[model samples]
Target: MPFFVYGTLRPGEHNHDRFVRGRDVRAQPAFLHGGALYDGPGHPFATDGDGTVRGALLTAAPAEYPGLLVALDRLETYLGPGDPRNLYERVVRPVEVPGSGTVRAWVYLAAPAVTRTLRANGPRIPGGDWLSHRPPRTDRLLPPPGPRTP
Candidate 1:
C-alpha cells in the first residue's frame, strides 16, 4: 500500500520538519477526487463531496509500514483510517497530479464539516498545532506592538 501524505505531513511543512524530518519526500501533483483539504482542529480531513489536494508522494519500504504507523500514532490520533474521529486514517484512493498519471497516494484528511464550521466562525487563530509549519502571507504578519504611551 502506497502511503500518500498531504497537509502538515508535507515536506518543509510543520509536521514534516518536526516529526518526520522530511527525509524522503518525492514531489507529485496529487488530487483528492471528492474532497477539499481544510485546516481542522489540529490537522486536515475530507468532506462529503469532491475536490482536490496536493502534496508529497513518499515511497516507504514494505517493512516501514509498521514503523510509519507508530510514528504517526500520536500525530494521527489512531482513529483507524477514514474515520472522522481519527486524526488521520489510511485510505487507498486515486488523485490527479498534473505530471503523474492517475496515481495512488496516501493522504491525511479531517472532517470538512469541522473545518467548514470553523471557517464560518472565523479565521483560524495561530496557536497550538496551527501556529507552525505554514509560512505567513505578508498581509497576515502582524506589525510589532506599538510603543507604550503614558
Candidate 2:
C-alpha cells in the first residue's frame, strides 16, 4: 500500500530516513487535493481545505506496510482510531501521482479541532509544500553564489 506523506515524513525531512527509508519500496512525488497545511510545533499538519498538498506517495511492501503503519502511528502520536489524544488520523485519500495518475493512499490528517486551532494562528505553508516553506539551513557548506566583488 502507498502512503502519502506531506510533512517531516517526506524525504530529507526530519523523520523520513528514520521512519520511511528502507521500509518503502518506491516513492513518487504526488499531490493531495483539497487540503491546507500548517506549521505545527516541530512538524506540519494537513487538513481538508480548498488547496493542494505537495507530497510523496510511498509504496511499502505488503509485509512491511503493517509494521510501518504501526511505527508511523506511534511516531505521529496516534493512539488509535477516534482517540482523543490522537494528533493525527490515518485515512485513505486520493493522491495525484505524476505519471501514474490518481491512487488511493493512506494519509495522516490533523483532527478537526487541532486543525482549527493551528489555522487560527499558526503559519500556513504557502502552496502546501513543507519542503518549500522551510528556512534554508545555516549549517550547509555550499559556497556563496559568485565571488564577492568588493
Candidate 3:
C-alpha cells in the first residue's frame, strides 16, 4: 500500500525513523490538492479542499502493510473509522507523484470540525511545505529582572 505522509513522517523528521524508515520499500516526493496543512503542536494537521500539500508517497511491501498500518495508527492515535477520539483519519486520496502521474494513496487528515477549529486558531503552513517553516522567535524583552531583591 502507498501512504502519503507529511509533517514528521517525512524523511529526516522525528517520527520518520520510528514509523516508516525500514518498513517502507519506497518513498518519493508527491503532492495532493484540495486540502490545507496547519501547524498543530508538534505536528501538522490536514484539512479539506482548496489547497495543496507536499509530502512523500511511502510504499510498503504487501506483507508489511498490515503491521505498518497498525504502527502508524498507534503513532497517529487513530481509532477506527468515525471514532470520536481519532486524531487523524486514514483516507485514500489521489496524490500526484512526479514522473508517475496520479496514484491513490492513504493519507491522514483531521475531522471536519477539527479542521474548522484549526483553521480559525492555527497557523496555516504556506506553500503546503512543512520543512521550510521556521518557528517564531522566543527571545525575552529584557534580562530576567536580575533575580528578585530581598
Clashing pairs in 3: 34-49
**TM-score rank order:** 2, 3, 1
Residues 23-60, candidate 2: write the lDDT tens digits: 74578899999999988876889998889999998888
Model 3 regions lying over 4 Å from their true place? 134-150
Lowest lDDT 10-mer window, candidate 3?
134-143
Supply candidate 2's per-residue lDDT for 141.
Answer: 57
Against the hidden true structure, what lDDT does model 1 obtain?
0.55
> How many clashes does each candidate structure show, in the order listed?
12, 0, 1
Clash pairs of candidate 2?
A: none
Per-residue lDDT over 1-150 for candidate 3, one digit per residue giving the tens place of the 0 to 100 score: 698998888887768877777774588999999989898887889877689999999899998899989999889888888888888888999999999999999999986667778978988999998878745323333566567878
User: Which candidate wins on TM-score?
Assistant: 2
- Which portions of model 1 show Cα errors greater than 4 Å? 22-25, 81-85, 111-150
TM-score of each: 0.60, 0.87, 0.85
Better of 1 and 3 by TM-score: 3
Candidate achieving the largest lDDT: 2
Who is ahead in lDDT, 1 or 2?
Answer: 2
Q: Candidate 1, residue 12: CA error in Å?
A: 0.7
Model 2 ranges off by over 4 Å: 137-150
